[model samples]
Target chain A: MSVLEVNHVSKSFGSNTILQDINLAFEENKIYGLLGRNGAGKSTLLNIMTNRIFPDAGDVKLDSENINDNDTKLGLMYLMSEVNLYSNGTTLKQIISDTELMYGDFDHSFAARLIDEFGIDINQKFGKLSTGYNSIFKLILALCVPVKFVLLDEPVLGLDANHRELFYSELIQSYSDNPRTFIISTHLIEEVANIISDVIVLDQGRIMLDQPVEDVLAKTHSVVGPAKDVERYTKGLNVIGHDTMGTIKANYVYGDLDDRPLPDTVQLSNFDLQKLFIFLTNKYEGSMHSEN
Target chain B: MKTNQVTKYLFKKQIVLLGELYLFAFAIIFLLPLLLSVISGTLSDYSFVGLLKGAHIAALFGIFMIAISTLSYENFKFLIQNGISRKTFFEAQLTVYGILILIGNTINLFYDYLIVVPLTHASTFNTFMSLYADFFDNPFVSVTFNFIFSALLLVFGALAGMTVGSFMTLFSKLTQRIILIATPVVGVVTMAYVANATNNAHYQMSWVVNFAKFIIGENGNDVLNPFPMMGFLLVLSAIMIVIIRYLFAKKQLKKA
Candidate 1:
């Protein structure tokens, strides 16, 4: 069943429209990746879904009820990059106390354990923590909280490589243990490619792609062959992106890869999420520029 | 569960704010007086009794400051974004502030009796009784005049703070900018008004002037009339608070 449903939602700031007639549904017990470029309205859509911000038109429902009627649906943890916990005088212990107070099922023990694992000083004030540690601390809290849904916006934005790997491992482990809905929104698409069960690509506030991760990967393939042969073979297919090198060519093609056979000389590779995102956004940009 | 959640959140917030208030009160009551006593020694002849009275007045002013400062844009934003309703939040703040003011007043009264009276070799009980008499004299008159005037000042200060805080919320992107620009302008305008009013006798006694006098304790006509001015300020404050709560209830948090 869909745990979250956003229907025909539109949002505008003055004359600049942010989200336009967007619709999406989130299923329970799945890890979904929400990917987009900067200023693509991904965060705005998340805010509307979480009831942090109201939409100009349309409604978001959680568990079949309007979110505004019961904003406790916001009790569903939303760890946005911008919506920081207190800084200056606030400590991790105080934050835990606050979280336990505000949320019914906050796992204090789990949070403590995660804090220990992340090497966060419980006594240190939030403002004193390094940027990477700040992100780690927030991620730990989001993972430990026993809410029905958890939305992590750019959770690993400041993490080093090691911490990023550790974050993904902990996130996966937590999901496996609790089996709740998790929506991870980030520009770092490839980092979460393995963990996300579903992928939703947003562009200009519209959902460009929403499908199972496996299906999305299977539908797109990269072809490397002679430039003329690649162009001829890629004709009538949706070529997301292409590059040429000394009479040889590489093209990112989107379609049912399993349904067609390529020439023996052509090298085929599975499309990575990062490459897919870059291709899609670049394609949109190219089209817009051409139109202009 | 809802009550527990709100209480916990509000309690945490209040604890932090109270710490700041204590520091502020300590500075104003203990430190400032000590500095003044050292600077001129003008208060040296007054004895501790006068010092206690001064402290009592300072404490009352501190309570007013605390009440006003508690209403902020951050608090409003939290109320709107979190599941906590604006009505509930405002009621909680009012309840907390009222309790705090009562406690502060009690402590001040105790200090007046315990420390001031003995030091001055004065009858503290007699002073208390006289003050009470002063408060209730001509039941209708004193109630209308002094008591109501002071109450209105407190309410007006709080309403002013909340209204300004609400306006600050609208300039969310450039809150610091707005504050930086508006603070000096407000300060200058207020000073200019004060200077102008002190020089103009007719302007001072106008109905507007009388109302301002009633607020600031400058009205010389002390025929102990139940200060309807206090009721006026209270009702005005109540209206502003209601409007503030309504606007806050409808507000939404900005997106990530």
Candidate 2:
């Protein structure tokens, strides 16, 4: 069953609409990636889904009930990138105590273990911590909070390479152990591409693409060959993206790659998420060829 | 977690915010008196009794600062975003701010007795206590009156600040930028008005003397008892709090 449903939701600031008629459904026990460009209303959508921001129109429901209902039965948690814990004079230990008090299922032991693993100082004030550590601290709390639906918005924005790897590892482990619905909204598509079971691409406050990772991957492929041959072979195909180097050309094609073998001068390659995202998002200016 | 669970989280946030405000209050209270004494070239003969009285008045400034600092645009935005009922959040902040001010006053009074008294003259402690006794002589009447007046000032300040903060948050970025420039100008105008109202020749002004009477009690000759005024202030404050809470609850959490 779907764990989250947003139905024709719209949000406007004064007369300027930020999100319009956005609709989506998310299932349980799956890792979903929410991909969008900046100001595409990705965070706004997440905020509305998590009940942080109310929609101007329509409704967002969790477990078949309006999320704003005071039932206390729906387990939902949102970790926003902007709404951080107190930055100054609050120790990690104090934050843990406060979290435990706030979240009934907050696991202190798990938090402590994560803190140790992340090498965070228990006595250091949150304000004094580096940006990477600050993000880690929030991540630790987010993971330990036992909520059925967890929404993480750009969780790795400020982390170092090593910490990002560590965070992803911990996130995967936590999801495996808990089996909850996790919606991760990020611009770093390539980093989370392999782990995301489902993908939702948002563009201009609307769902541009929503499908299982396998289905999405299946529809996209890259063809590389001599420039002239590659162009000729992909002439009638839906080309999402393309690149060229001198006489060589590479093209990202949408739809079944297995239905047709590569031409003699062309080689077929599997599409990666980075290339796919670039192709899908950068397809506006005649970058994608229509099958017509 | 239950709805009550969020209260605990909010209280923790309140404590952290209050601590910062308390420190800010202390710095202002301690520094102002010292700065005034130095500027007057009376540092050598600075009377502890005078300093104690000044500190008491300075401590009251914390109520204003607390009102301004706590009801910030970001805080209101946060309260709305977190799904905290505005009534609950406002009451929580008021409760927290009241507690912090009381604690801050106690500390200021203590520091007056300990440091200021010793630095100037220990003999003046009795005089200071007498003044305090005179100020708080009729415990039931004086306490009721002062409490009501203080609560009114706090609520008024908080509401005004919240109104401005909310406006800033709801307005466009360009408007906010403009208001950022106008804020200090508005502040200066308010100070000028206050100065004119409290000038010596205008000391008999009904509002001025009424406010002073609430703070320091009747100046021995005043025939008007402040009990009714106290009751009126209390009722007004309660009404304002309710209105502010209602507005805040219904207001949208618009982003800047």
Candidate 3:
């Protein structure tokens, strides 16, 4: 299996750092959810990996070969950035045709189907497309390009509820049909929770958590009930965060549970991916503030 | 990635643009004379081919090149999004311009002979052949001289256009604004000073005339050899190409 590796990558704009010694490895045939807060270096990391921007320190390698300025290796991956790089006057059909030419291979039939389903006029200029259609067209490109790895940054930026759901379904179908690696960085966590096999979380220029979605969800629990009982039951565990309402409280813990008997009016249950992500990122960010 | 393929694509686009320009120029070049003849009933008096000469072609080609340079930013964004590296992008852009400089000069030469020469019975219509053709006994040698002279001018003009284009695209907005503001201010000040009848201004104007004489190899009665002008163009173009390449390599792309 082919793998993409980022070795000790660090990036900054001026004196303000964006990514700090970030190290990551993504293998083939896996869907990864890259979660990060606003300005958490998610876009910068994706851009650096694709060589859209350079990293100040370290390099990106694919299959142990340096991909920097290497056309053969760079051709095997694609990054659908948030900004549209195609000319404004170019029609969608022309853009698709040019993209196919550049990549040397494209799923024309699949692209046609997506274009039709999305009700996009192929003859209309890219500049004329609304924000939703722009994102739709970009995502279609991300899914259709015949590459080993597809990195999507804000894939559903302007997508509506219906379109987002359609996109997720199509994404799963495409993965099942093609079996390529996908690294999707987005703020919509609950939606991609069940879709991505692995989750990598970033907070304040650091990798806060990287684990399989199932493992992350399994280790995470919400101790809900009376405030005192919940606190007692969750004491000494990795209590990342909590929500309290008067006498009642729910503690979000992320670790192995103790074998102690449950006290009266205290209950324990599993938490979703979004809650765990929130807890992890908020804890690290809060810690940074406290340290400062 | 696939730098050759990308270069070929860019070259084709430039050719298409050039072809459109040729079509427009040809229409105006050929049709305007006929229109004037119909309206005023006199065609022999009007200078048709002389209106467009080698220097004029150089200026037109320079403008075409400047336009191409302005598009470099948009092209860079598109190509980078398609996974083309900066090195490949620079190589492809230079290659396209290098090829265009040759091809464009040849096409201009072809048009001058095929269209302009037949229209006017004049022996020499281009800047080089107008003054320097007497040195060459044969018409073929004179035409070749015209081609070389025009090509050298085209290259120098292209370098100038690329400089302007690179400046506009590669630099920060503030830097561009400062340069834009300063160039005209400096130009107007120098023009005002040089326009004066002072002895210093006359000395400066005489120096310019002497430089022109040296370029033309003119001692009032000698053959105007173009070797000096060719050498000057080649050296200046080499230096400007280096500066342009440095700017290309060092440029950090913006999000816009």
For this target, which candidate reaches the highest TM-score against the unseen true structure?
3
Q: DockQ of each candidate's interface versus the true one?
A: 0.26, 0.14, 0.48
Q: Give lDDT tens digits, candidate 3, residues A221-265.
A: 888999999988887888988999999999988988979888879
Docking class of 3: acceptable
Taking all chains together, each candidate's TM-score versus the true structure is 0.80, 0.69, 0.86
Pitting candidate 1 against candidate 3, the one with the higher TM-score is 3
Q: Please list the C-alpha lDDT of all candidates, in the order they appear.
A: 0.69, 0.67, 0.82
Q: How well is each residue in A1-292 modelled by candidate 2, as lDDT tens digits?
A: 6568889999886786788898888888999999987887888887777555568899977778776533242345545454553546778887677556545667777787788888989898877978788888878877887677778888987788988998999899999888888899998898999999999888667777899999988888688999988888888898888888989999889877445556898988688766777666756423334533
Q: Residues B1-256, candidate 2, lDDT per residue (tens digit)?
A: 3445555555566566666765775567666666788999878765555644445543454455445543455454444333344455555655655655555455544565566656666433332243333445565655454444444555455555555554455566688888899989999999998777668557467776666676444556634444444565566657766665655555444453
* TM-score, structure 3 vs. true: 0.86
Candidate 1 CAPRI assessment class: acceptable
Candidate number with greatest DockQ: 3
lDDT of 1 by residue, A1-292 (tens): 6478898999999898888899888988889999999889988887777666779999988877787636366566454455663545678777766655656657767677777777889888877888898888778767776676788888988788988888888888888888888999999887888889999988887788899999988888888999888877777888899888999999898876545667777888887888888988878878889999
Ordering by TM-score: 3, 1, 2
Per model, how many backbone clashes are there?
10, 0, 0
lDDT of 1 by residue, B1-256 (tens): 2545665566567666666776787687677777877788776653444555445553455555545554555554544434444445556665555554445444544564566656665442332233333546465564344333444455566556666655555555577577869899999999898777777776654887677666434445543233354456677888887776766555566433
Cα lDDT over the full model 3: 0.82
Higher-TM-score candidate among 2 and 3?
A: 3
State the fnat of candidate 2 relative to the true structure: 0.14
Interface RMSD of 3: 1.8
